[model samples]
Target: MAALQKKQSINCKVLVLGKSGVGKSYILLQYTAPPQEIVQMPKLTTVGVDYKYGTEKIEDTEVKMSIWDTAGQEKYRPIIQTYFKNSKAAILVFDLTDKQSLQDVRYWLREVKLQCGKDVAKILVGNKCDLPHEQPDQALIQEYCEEFQMEYIESSALQKINIQEIFVKLAKKIYQQHKASIPQNQLKQNSLPANEAQNQNSTSSNKQISLKNSKPKQKKENDGCC
Candidate 1:
C-alpha cells in the first residue's frame, strides 16, 4: 500500500465553546498530546479563554489550527464571546452523561450564532461518550444538529474516542469554506495586473501630452520669429 503523505499546513482559527466541565480543554489536549507520559487531568477551569496550537491534516491540505478553548462558566460567558471574533469554525460540546449539559447546548448554539455570525461552520459535540447509559436522547441531539445544520459527533476525550475525527471534520468544514472563496480572490487578483498596467499607460500618455502642451511652439521660418 502507498504511504499517506501529509501536506503543507495553512493557519486557521477554530473555537471550542461549551458549558464548564464538559471537557472542552481535554478535547484540545487529546489532540495536542503531552509528551507520551502519564498526564494528569487538569483540574483548573479555563479562565477567559485558553489557546492551543496544533495541526490537522485533512486530505491533501494541512490546517495549522489555532484552537481556542473558551471559558464555559456563566460568569465568563461575556469574556469568552470575544474569542469568537476570529473563529472560522466552532465545536460546541455537551456532556453526554449530564442532562443539563445537554440542555445548555441550545443556549450555547444560540450564542455561537449570534456572536460568531451565521456563516461560521459549527459542530455539536456530545462529549464524555464513554460514560455508561446517558438519558440525553440521541434522537434529540440528532434533531438539534439537523435543525441547526451542524455536524454531530460523540467523543470521549478521556478515552480518546473520535477525538481526532472531531477536529478533522471541523477542519474539513473550515477548509471548504476557505476553498470556496479562492475563486473570487483569484478573479480580483487576476484582474488587478491588467487594470494597473492600463492605469500606468494612461498616466504616462497624459504626462507626455501635458509636456507637449506646456512647451513653447516652435518658430516657423515663414511666420514671426521669436
Candidate 2:
C-alpha cells in the first residue's frame, strides 16, 4: 500500500476493528503515513476512533479509503460503535502472540454484524505474526472464520509484513461488494475505445476492475470470496 496520493473517485470506509495493543495504529501508520510524518504512539491505545484518509494503488486500481482506527478497550466501545453503520468493510485484528486475543474474535464480529450494513466486508486479522512464539493453528484459524463468517490473515506491523496486503485484499473485497454502486462509465471496459471495449467484452470484464479475479485467491476459507 502506497501513501495517500492525489484523490480518486473510488472511495470507501474501512473500519480497523480490533482489541487494544493489536498493532492497529502501527499497521495503519505503516500503510498510510509517509515516512517523514510517521508518529509513533507510545501508548498504542486509541481513545475512541481515529480517522485517516489515503489512496492505495492496488494492482492498478487506485482506492481512496477512509480508515477508521477504533479503540479496542471495552469502555470506548460505545463511542466508536456509531461509525460501524457507514463502514463499508472491517479489518478485525488480534494479537497473534496472545492466544486470548484469538478468542475475542467473536465479540468484534458480532459487533460489526449488529451495527454495520448487512453486506459489509469483514476480515479477521492476526497481528504480530513475526513474533517467535507458538503460532495459531491453521485448523483453528479456518474453523474460527467459518463460525464467524469473516476472513483472517496474520501480519506483523512492526516488521511491515502483510501490512499492505491486509488493506489491499480487503479493499478489493469491498470494491466487489459495492460494485453495483459504481457508475457504468467507471468500469474499465466502458471507458475504453469502441474497438477496445469490444475486445474486453469478449473476456470476463469485471476481472479487470477486481485484479484478484485473475488470481488464485485468499485467506478466510469460509468468509467467502471477495
Candidate 2 per-residue lDDT over residues 128-204, each given as its tens digit: 87887686767867876787566777888887899888887887776666566667767664446566566566566
Whose TM-score is greatest here?
Answer: 1
Q: Which segments of candidate 2 are over 4 A away from where they belong?
A: 1-8, 38-41, 58-61, 147-149, 180-226
TM-score of 2: 0.72
List clashing residue pairs in candidate 2: none
lDDT of each: 0.80, 0.76
lDDT of 1 at 92: 87
* Residue lDDT tens for model 1, 1-226: 3223323456878888888999998888888876475377666578898888887777557888888988888999877777777777888899987788888888877877887777777888989888895567878788778877789888998888999899888888877776776798564543355556567668999999999889688966866555
* Per-prediction backbone clash count: 0, 0
Alpha-carbon RMSD, each predicted model: 8.7, 17.0
